[model samples]
Target: MSAKESGRNVVAGIGVRGWLRFIWRQLTSMSVALMLLMLLAIAAIPGSVIPQKMSNPQGYARYIEANPDRVAWMEKLQLFDVYTSVWFSAVYILLFVSLIGCILPRIRVHYRALRNPPPRAPKNLLRLPAHAQASGVTRDDEEMRRRAVGWLRRSKRYRVICDDEPGGALVVRAERGYARETGNLIFHIALVGLLVSVAIGQLYHYRGQVILVQGRGFANAQVDYDSFSAGSAFDPASMCPFRMTLDQFDAKFRVSDAQAQDFTAHVTIDDNATSSKEQIKVNHPLIIGGAKIYLQGNGYAPEVEVKDADGEVAFAGAVPFIAQDNVYTSLGTIKVPDVTSGDQIGLVGYLLPSAEQSESGAWKSVYPDLLDPVLVLTVWRGDLGLDNGIPQNVYELDTDNMTQVAKDGKVVTLVVRPGETVDLPDDLGSFTFNGVKRYVALDLRHDPSLTMVLIASIAAVIGLAMSLFIPRRRMWVRIAGAVASVGGLAKTEDENLQREVRSLAEYIAAPDKAPPVGPGQAIQEGKAE
Candidate 1:
């Protein structure tokens, strides 16, 4: 082939090969890993900036209510929920692939280096980073080589070699820290392991919360939970179904003081089917079958008893209410479908946990702990919605279609205390506030696959340590024959041998005689005087 044609073929081959090599190098480079790290950080930015759906779905609804336009814009950009965004997943996937690409090859390289010998020292010892010499090391050539090798060996540099040629011998040296390269590879791989572990945790774990009433029992089921969610691959059946039954909940607050610092709840829990009863305090919890139960808190429900004109028991139960004040609180309820000779009567009342009379005779709470607790009742004699399919709150009376008959024109609001009874005129019967009983709130949660996540995290740490703390290095040495140069030796006889002439000269320092350097140069120039 002609030179030009051959060159064309060679250039074409190189172009193709170089492209592949560039790709391989990029995949294996630390720069690529660092860039992936940056990408990962950027991907995580949205998770923190945007409220995750799992943490607060209703809170986002509130945000939407307040900032309709802003919420719309954020939703358009997937900011309201970014964790499940396609862009974030893409970033993590690409990072994982690149990390594996870099780590797998490093493993092979480390294995080979461990099994192979280190390179010999370089022939030119003076060219090394640090070098020194001493003619007094030894006079005999073999003795010199032995002494140099001995010095290096004693210094812990293994595999020291002595190379003897015509003129002299050069020493070769090496050490056993070559396995440092493997340590570096382990460190990198360990980081990749960490990433995998976190991804597993995100994909296989289950986390949610369930709020149950004090007397109620909540099963660790998806539908029973108030708000529940699992990882992408989590199985609902695998969730810890450790049913917890609240046997009893006890709460005692500090004596009606300014600061109720001594608030605590003692709970008795029955682990479902475990047949074991556990007592749990405010801070302590009972753990059974991977489920934990605690006395989270408690609230009061005013106990009321209702009766007809014939003294027939109409209603006798506790009505729970949310506290209005931190200490002093408000509790209220509406009663519908009161029967009187096959007719219906409606009643509404506001109960105060600690009822206190105001200057104007209006009733309100002075504290949360039912001190002189009272209820204000207003009765209406009409349709109590018993015929309607719509449900009514036992704590609330639907007065959408009822009329008041007790001391008012359609409605009346008043207060009643414990042992207090209010009679209904026009055959509406009566109701009484007997006392108050406290109710408790329970929260349950279950999560699976935390163990897998932890294992992956630990493996990643080990791999990272191995990869970072190791370095790869080698040295080479070769002793070539030194050629004799008689012509050069005769040309610089006086100048080259000047140091020897110092012994021949009487004085080491001279005032004249062309100084040692001048005469040495003149001799080289063949201009001897």
Candidate 2:
């Protein structure tokens, strides 16, 4: 045939319908489903290794800052958002569809098999894998058939059916272990449920973090959190109407090595007119109103009162300091933007919990406890960047347009202890170190699909156990004038099938006292004809 004619004939043979059928068959096959499942797992690896924007924004920012050139390419590939990426979603959707397609047909077939009866006994039973025969039985054919059928049903729990042969013989066909297929189907169905639950959770869950100083209150609102991330479908109005106050916070550290021993945050929660006091600790979360509040971290917030040159208080609140070392050496920023004196004043400083002057004349914290707390600060005068309409980090002070306070052509530093006040240079202001209060960083998470996920996980485990341990097998028993035959077949390789058949044959021969025989052994010396 000519090349063009051959191509035309091939196209005619396999049209659009044939091509679609072939694709559907391949996509719905068990092998394809398993491969897709594996591919989904592989796709999740990038989400773990790379910093995800939704889960770890700080880490993602750091990664972008460190690898500025790669950020564009990585974002284009959706590496930072692996779970929500188009490729990952496509794999997930394909796996879901494949599992459903593969399971539905198997379920239909299994259902039909459940409604149908066991197959008829074969003509030659000796050809089976496990077979046994007995001759010279004293019982009548009717009694033998009755006893065999009754024993198979009552003792072995097999679904049995008996029929009369044409030549005064009886045949009993029995089968059991339909639960194997049932469990297999249940396992696949549970997998689909788990996938759906996870998808819902990824679409509607919300998580946020907040830092609360002692004696401060916080409400459950999107605007209250310092950092918040939520699924695309999450709504701010759905948040529970709850309020919490940090009444107190406590921390303990080892004396010798300054290792942190424990941390606890005491808080009062008010939800919908109900009020309760609770203590939150690491790993132990407070669950309320379908949300869980976890104590993520703890630090110290130094209470300070900043006054302008006119002695009017400009800033009076606790400023949280990020801990820099195990000894509680912390860094903080205090911005006095509303000062009515000179230019806007900013104070950048470190808090040393247990102050100790080093050999180099630098102050550092020798211990985590408040042995000799001191604030070491540097004053600045500038615009404070408040009127620029640009959002800034509360813990960071922008010093680009600021001039450091100088004394005799050298930058001046101020050291203030608790209850002590230090004056600023150039008559900017004065700041008093009142005291220190403990603070706690809390993370609240709400996932409405958690219950469904937990239930589906448990069901999947049970179904898998059932499918693995259960055995499917069939047994047949035939009785003639004074002889009987028994045979068994296992869906899989079961070593006990021969023993069961032999036991059945022996029981038919002698109901009260059956002969003991090894597995796969015939009761009689000659094979049945």
Candidate 3:
């Protein structure tokens, strides 16, 4: 329409380059960077509260099954994989860019400031915040200036420059504490290093979990782990070749409340280069083969023997029972697919350590120790669904196509103790409860960037301390025909600035009476003039 209207439209539009510049400035601001860091911490809360797919597959599956209506929405939002989610990655990348953008310009400015000298002294020293003047100086102007410069250089350890004013007065300007800004820059640089180290650790780390029954051996292979997860850059071949056998597991519980007190897993580890015996406790881990083995949990695995009706041993082994209660009430499953006749059988039941009969004629455990252990089970005859080529959880039994063994039109519950045998209904089979053994769940983790992360963390702490405690300051001394004046200025709110200026003025007035220089009295010296 009109030139003015077109110009107004153009100004309002803020063309592509202008908009880009504005966005970059906002993103690189320190306030925005801090906000993003806080947001990242908040976003990690979900990963800790909810079961992550990579870290806890079985728990994730159970959650999905328990909350079917919410599963679809949760998965759609990538809540099940929070750390690797698209939104999380976007935030992480933006924070990285913001920190780098905030650091580069500061580094350049600091470099230039380091090369240049401190600002010249002001005309009138008495106008400064911290100022002192000594009128009765016996020394000449040149002698006073030289003494002041020497005291600032040797005793106070400041960078000194001597200049003659146009009015024939001698000025000694001194400055110190460039290290304050250097420490600040170092802290920010170390922060960036820490972020990069963490990202690298995430990309190259691997973790696996396995349950080891007593006397059973395990190898460091992908197939040996019950559950395993690794970063995108991790390779299976990079795993350290190590083998270990569970010797024994010891657990102690308090007698009064049956609360567990201690747990230890004794193991023998054999790496390709060496072998050793080690004990892994709850907080103490075994470090070998570039991996850390942690004892995560402990439970009982009851040994059992199963025989078909034809008197043939069908199955036998120690079955791990997950503890469900404080007194060691555990649940487990046993499947017999090699039965000689009829159909497959599944024994689903609980093991009660220190078993006792309740008032209602129910079996329960009273203590965590194995004083009177018993097995209470129910027999089911059916297809175990193992031959269907689908993976199944060993801890669970699917009875959808199975029928419970019954006697006289009533369900039969088998009650057996260690070293006892019982007959099954309908002449199907015989089940025996053979003693119990302990098992331990172990988690192994390998991270290549741990050293770098540790060093960066330490450096960050040191730099932060320096930036907070060290003070940047400048001092000026002017001597003209027996009148000597001193002034001090600090970049930060320094409480001792006035005291320091007064002390310097007194020293300049009578250098012979000043205290001798000592190591404790020395401040950090800056570049020489």
Candidate 4:
């Protein structure tokens, strides 16, 4: 179709024509394209300032918590999560619409340009910026004109026109870099395509987080997780068959007089599936059953022995303890239900990986490994707050509903070194330190769409590059005759010299040449003469 009709159809189909029509038109306008390019750069600021959803969520929550009122307002404004904000989506959609609108019209115009040669070279050649004349060349005007046209076709990139009048004249034109517009459009369209691809990922992809304590073998289920959030079209079945067992954990740290470095942990995971049996570390993740299993951290596991008033060992095993300061030192609890013990009773203790007697007579860890591990006991008899419905830290000792009976003061102390047992003097009974076991904190994740998203991202990038760097250009050619004034100039070197000395080529060839060029050229050239 014709370019004019095609452009009209596009506008009509979109149902817009008014002052706002400029908005729609300008949105698709080249001006709007430049604006979108700038807008994308400006829009990226919020993602960096605020904590993105991809990063630590708790830290971002803390930021919101710090300013409840402001964050609430920001949420309303979608500023906190700008990438997923409705306003951001609107900007993206508008930019895309503008892209299509602009490209279609340009495509139509380009098609038209390709089909039509430039309007017959301007009627007045002397009126143009580039015009030159010479007189007194070959006597045959056609031959001189033909020679000039050949020169234009060879070096001037022009479809030439010549006059049959006396000394003959030629017209030449050339154009280059016209394909730059096509390149610009491709770049814009590629940007729109990339946005669409990113939106598809944002709407269709899913990711979740799960925190597993030591000795915990979590199944890939909806429950028993710290948090979970899914994409709009995410499906639970897309989750991989994730089953992780924290088989064994080992941590080693540098023990030096100065700085401590070279922190390392080794963990063994078995899933009974493909790539199941593997050893993982902090930087290395084990691929188990099509999921990534990382040993996020490691902590102490104190060997605890529990006994009742009946002199029977009710519980005896290594209880997971969280590290507090350094050197694998951890805080853990040994809870004994009041119903089972017939009284509210619990023991909270701090265990150290390597304990040393400071010069001030305080306990501290000299190293992280269990070289001479020790656990200083602080006795507490209380009702454990399990049924209180209040969340408690697994690495803390809750001293509610009870008190410390005896004050050991500076003299009170008991350090159960590794392989040693401490005996209680009262009927509270005694426990032995058998051995210790280290446990790893594994973060097991499964996202079936991760690879697909990556693939789409790569494709989008390549498409974008192809569209940006490549340009499409074209040339249009029109040819006709030169004017009489040009044709009549200087058929001989004699006339050329005579023209320089005031000759009369224009008076002779003004009637039978390429339009007014013959007249305009003669008038201009004679003045110069």
Candidate 5:
């Protein structure tokens, strides 16, 4: 290789190394840390605004169906799953690395500083921020120095050092408040710990929700939940071994507008080795087997019995109704896919707890309580498209291929109250409204690192308090011949240093009596020079 080519290669390597160092320094700067934190916060907005598929599959699906044109773009941006998105994870991971790089070196420097004493007394004490001079404390230099050191030691406030100057004057250097620096380091370290705790908690967490009607039971298994979501490192087999049976659900409402006041679920739990009963209410959860169960909602489920044309019972169970208003006006759908005689049937309509007729001949609900409950259903009969193996929304009925059953040249309408039976049109079937039962929604969650997160939060709070409240300062007392000079300096601009210097001079001048004047007045007069 020629010498010019070799020199060019060397210069290129040096350029690359220097560029990398610059990048590292910028990443670890406090400005970058604040920016990354703000970016992380901005990135989390989509998680709350858009429904996540892992938590609400039905709602998410409906959203996609409503915006068919945006699905591809939204998927590419990972808006549906913001917390687990690759870009979000990268941002937080980089923040964690930056904090580590910034805090570790500060901790090392602060540790070394604590082991060393304060610097020697300055040469020109008159040039300090606050200086005080006292005469006639003692005629001998040795006696004045002894009294000053004795007074500083008795106060027990500063780290004192006594040394001899070139002119045979005694110089005493004292410093305190190393804890100020230590606290600053600790605050940064705690921030790093908080980030670690949150990351670990996210990795090992799992949450699932289930809806159980009165007299229904649930097992803590993956298949038993209506919807379950797990972390990236979560193991399904590690689920808590427990079973819950809901005995009763009670909902209380206010007198006006039927606003809900409280909801409580009475449940019995079995952990295979023991059994216990607990009442779970809003904001108060039941903790068992490292998992917490919370009560989120309550609604009414209408029980019904259906029979085909042959009089054989086809369906008998309670169907949960989704509430649409504060007065418990609910919407529900019932599909009978296994009828033995004729085409399958589907029923769709609203369940009114307090049924009322409007002036325009429309039926509506008047109250949340079941004062006079009624079911107004529209009947359809045809192919339900159930055999295609595609999942269908349980709450919605697809009637694209169904024929509406009518009676006397009008569309058929079945109105049934509690314990009422009505015959279907075209001799299709018979339907009866049995009764109404209450149901409660429960969420179970577990995270192994929650304790660490709590500890880190407490540490961060304490470090923050110390870093803000503690002060860093230095003071020096020098005795030359019969005169004593004191000077003070503080890390921050405040009046405490001036006050402290004047007080020390007074204390040395009058060991058993109060000084004649205040520290502030003395400092002002001295500054006139």
Candidate 6:
């Protein structure tokens, strides 16, 4: 092809290589990286606002039930598993890729610049952003160049070089702020390291929760946990063998306003051969076997007893109730699938600590402390739904196949206090309330990459500070025989550059003599302007 035709084709359209270069340049631009970062942050918001099924199945289930109309869409979008959702993952992955693309080229450019010397001095020093002149100098060009080089080197802040032009003019070129670009590169590199650490942590971490009543113990086993979540790569066999026993649970409330003050769970831990006791409270976790045990919640578990119509003890134990409010109003269900001498029975009840009657004549808890506790029970008798073998929530009662126990066509409301007994309708059973014991909800978590994340975070902060404080600058001093000229240029417009040029001019020209007229007055005039 003719050279003119080739040039015409190139101008008409970009080839495949040119198109690829254009796309890459756009992706690696700082503006594109910033937009990706903002999009990633917005994508993470739903993870915090919505209840995640991986962490809290009960809460997620309640959310789904509460928003029945939106359940299908939420499930399809994986709103209940926001962190692992496809849309969130795509955004996170894109953000990391954009950052990497943006930083790699910058790193290469910075490395080359660090290896190269400061740029050559411009010929017209008078036209520079900052300039100062010293005329009628006693020393020659060689001495003036030597003194300027010596002074800059003595400052110990600049990379100094002296050179001579073809016309015998001496020049000294100095640069002091390479650290500004170095810090910028370090900050970006640390961000990449942090993202890698977080990805690794997410792949290997595990978290599980259990409710422990006072005096009860639990082993660190998958089957023992009420709910558990683990990374895709987590191995069950790698879990440390540990056991924890809840010795006591103490909760304090503000006497003035009845608000919760503090909660502490005293626990003894056995990690293989080692054993120790620790107080686990909110924000204070117990570390054992490379795992952390955090106190998440506290509530009352009422001790109850039930006897069949034949007067034989059927069920007797502590039933944990889910707390409904800060005042310790709790809801629970007790199912007696095998009564031995009577029909299967289910009891739904509410327990109130520090009970009192509201203005509307309804029962409510006045405080969180154990003062005048009351239990209101509603009895139901029929199939307990255990024969079908479907899993059911222990905290909820399935009353579809059950009939309420009533007298004179009205459902009986049995209100009994601690240490009191209430007989059931039709003499089916007898219920006894035997005070309450405290229980704690414990979250156990293990993440191997937490230390790496911390280190990267600290490095990022240091790099950011250095990048913000340091400024890139260059200075040049040129001497021709008896005349010396000083010039400076800064990457940013800064008053310090003018001051530095003025100061260097004053040093070159003897201070004992009268001040240099035009340049000194011009600097002062510029400053005033």
Best by TM-score: 5
Clashes of each: 28, 0, 0, 23, 0, 0
lDDT of 4 by residue, 261-300 (tens): 4434333343345434456766777665466766666667
Best candidate according to lDDT: 2
- Of candidate 5, the 10-residue stretch with the lowest lDDT total is 520-529
Candidate 3 lDDT at 242 equals 88
lDDT of 5 by residue, 99-187 (tens): 88788778889888788888988887878888888765534677666767776667746778889988888888888777877877778
Q: What is the lDDT of residue 321 in candidate 4?
A: 76
The sequence of per-residue lDDT tens digits that candidate 6 reaches over residues 1-529 is 8868777643457889989999888877889888988988888888889888776676777687678899899889998888888998887787788889988888889888888888898997877888887777765677767767776778637789888889988889998888888888888888988988988888889988899999999999888999898887889998989889999988888998888888889989887788888899899898877889898988888898988888888889889998898788999998887687657888998999888988986898888888988998889998887786555788778787899999999888788898999898889879999989999999999999889899889988888987888878898988886788888888876768887877777666653456644333322212322
Error of 1 at 343 (Å): 18
lDDT of 3 by residue, 1-529 (tens): 8868677644467889999999999999999999999998999899999999888887887787779999888999999999889999889988999999998998899888777876788998887878887775656788878878888899988888888889988899998888888888788888889988988988889999999999999999989999898887889999989899999888989988999999988899888868789899999999886899999988889999999989899999999999998998999999999998888899999999899998997999899888999999999998988886545789999897899988888788999999999998878889989999989999999998899999998989988988999889899988887888888889998888887887787676664755533322321111111
RMSD of 3: 5.4
Candidate 1 positional error at 399, Å? 15
Q: Which stretches of candidate 2 lie over 4 Å from their true place?
A: 1-11, 45-82, 252-262, 307-314, 324-327, 335-350, 356-367, 376-414, 424-428, 511-529
Local distance difference test scores for all models: 0.55, 0.89, 0.87, 0.55, 0.83, 0.83
Which of the two candidates, 3 or 5, achieves a greater TM-score against the reference?
5
lDDT of 2 by residue, 477-515 (tens): 888867788888889887778878877888777745554
- lDDT assessment of candidate 6: 0.83
Candidate 6's displacement at residue 129, Å, is: 1.5
Per-residue lDDT of 397 in model 4: 58
